[model samples]
Target: MWSLALLFGLVVCTLSVPTGRNSPAFAIEETAEWIRYEGYVAETHNVVTHDGYILEVHRIPYGRFQTASTAKRPVVFLMHGLMAASNCYILLGPQNSLAYNYADAGFDVWLGNARGNKLSRRHEELDPDNQKRDFFDFSFEEIGKYDVAQMIDYVLEYTGSEQLHYVGHSQGGTAFLVLASSLPEYNAKFASVNLLAGVGYQNYFPSLPLRTLARLTNTIYASAVALGLVEVAAPSFFRRGDDDSIINAVPEDEYLSELSTITELLRDGADDSDNSNMFGGAALKQIAHFGQNIRDKTFRRWDYGLLENRRVYGSVSPPVYDLSLITSNVTMHYTVSDVLLDERDVLAMVNDLPNARARKVAREDFSHLDFVAALDAKELLTDYIIESTVQIENLRSTGK
Candidate 1:
């Protein structure tokens, strides 16, 4: 799910992509409203980052059968991946959706939407549509650093909860790592963390077209910067513009169609074919950040070139995230068939963190999207995570 295909699909599919492969998918009417329609209690909380971006986080305070409470149950904060909104959690309905299941299991569920997505696009200062260049200048560094940090602080303060149980999929997981590693103080804020197809350590990306697209995006971004057109959407860059520097390089290989996962990819939480809110939007800088990781094979901060890097980071290059700083217990679950994030990449990330481990998805044929959208995800993955969280809570309660 954390590939250039998804970046393009999320950033362009709904706007200017051709009809067949990269077309837009169905978007949910409203996340909270949809949850309420399903006989569940839903709440919306708007959190402002330190940098002025406002994020919309959804909450399922209790189960359909249980009463809503002020006393506070165990809190589970579920964050979505790149180009996805918090709605991805409940898209499969109450039965298969992880958010609904967690709520049903007596846990307070908080759904987080990253900045640049539809639900969280508002900011205190710059208007996204009016000031496109400045509004879109940030990358995931700001996300993991300012956005995730403020959101976590807000969630804890709002619920009066001391700690949270975190579950981050793809870029969400990367955000967690960014927060934990960069700001180690936040590590103890999470009781447990589960990363589904954890998207850091991209040294072993398996998809060729995805790799090609990453390079192409990087090239286009550089060219755009040189041409004073910094904020680029995939539609503008991928289209056959007269500037052939980045145009004629679109991957048209026959096997490229085999990577039809783009069809399932979400943009603005609407790509689910059977009435879903799984797709979401992203910024061009966010896409380029991941693309840089794909090309350089380093999970470092976004590169700002030599002069700007020294000015912004006080170094010649971006510093790598120190995984060793993440002292909280983290379990990374990877599906064997995930085309974008290889198992080895997940394992390598696991090896870096002192308190991290890797768990392969039980389903052999599980793809990247299956971690969230699979029909049997509860049985295959979330069930185990829920059970594990239960055991952890029980141990804490018993002081064992």
Candidate 2:
């Protein structure tokens, strides 16, 4: 439940779902086009995972004011959370968004779209909308296992860099832990990892109403999946649309300007003929995976129940994702008011992570959406994160 995105997404499901993943209207405006629209050199890269999910990645090779340089800029990969496409990072526009801010800071920025989103919906042998049920048979677990792993390798290989800085929000961070824990070798591939309200443990979800809702949603999705609800696509009511105005929780006093910016961005995207969804698409399993965590109160693997667990894990229960295995330099950002992530849960994750620390957002009222959507967020937090990554790179380059 991405409070900001999901809340509005629920209301804005009015943004008509395209019958297919690759509708002509859907494919026209991608993250790269958004990047180029801002007068930056944007490169679109199609990275195929081992499992054949072709991920759509956008790159800002240099800053808006600066041209490509002989000196190779350090690369920073920005991943979106569930129901969000990479566009979320840039939708706030230049100077205010993460993708643009990282570029303006001279680091090569890569915006990543996970499978099931509008951008990365293509798979080698599956049609997402043509009754290919297996196409939707994945959760964040598979996302971490295949999607994140392949994208990371592709970025490193393309840039000829040994490691890159990672900044992921919510399920984005969840996928990183999935990769690092499942494939421990990938631990060495990061200069640093930043999780914005990164969720791995949910023993103490702050909101009772939302948690109860999540439990019901989880059961509904899981039951549906078992009964051949594998292919979750259009004509579907359970869709996530990306209009942030669906966010009704932001504190009135603090977010007037930021909320205005959000509305304006919505208007710009709403052409008479084009009802582009702010969020792309995600599998029901993705929601189910998070619901499992909220229900089970652990940051472990998917709970396939008894029978499927035996077939999948050779046991009656799924294995846990060991945060201890994620040895990368990790920084977690949490807020007192982020109903999705409690401070206790964040600390538990911090304790479990072998090499990790935690940062609390000063705005105790910061919503989960504020981590990604608020313009004031960078000043409250991300600026320091950017500086820290830069310093780490400086130290590495100088062999300090």
Candidate whose TM-score is highest: 1
Candidate 2, residue 183: how far the Cα is off, in Å? 1.0
lDDT of 1 by residue, 112-173 (tens): 88887778878999998777778878877788888888888999998888888999888888
lDDT at 343, model 1: 86
Q: Cα lDDT for residue 369, model 2?
A: 73
Give the Cα error of residue 154 in candidate 2, in Å. Answer: 0.5
**What are the lDDT scores of the predictions, listed in order?**
0.74, 0.73
* Candidate 2 lDDT trough over 10 residues, lowest sum: 4-13
Off by over 4 Å in 2: 1-28, 214-219, 226-276
Model 1, residue 129: C-alpha shift (Å)? 0.5
**C-alpha positional error of residue 348 in candidate 2 after TM-score superposition, expressed in Å:** 0.9
RMSD of 2: 8.5
What is the Cα-based lDDT of residue 56 in candidate 2?
Answer: 90
What TM-score, over all chains together, does every model reach?
0.84, 0.83
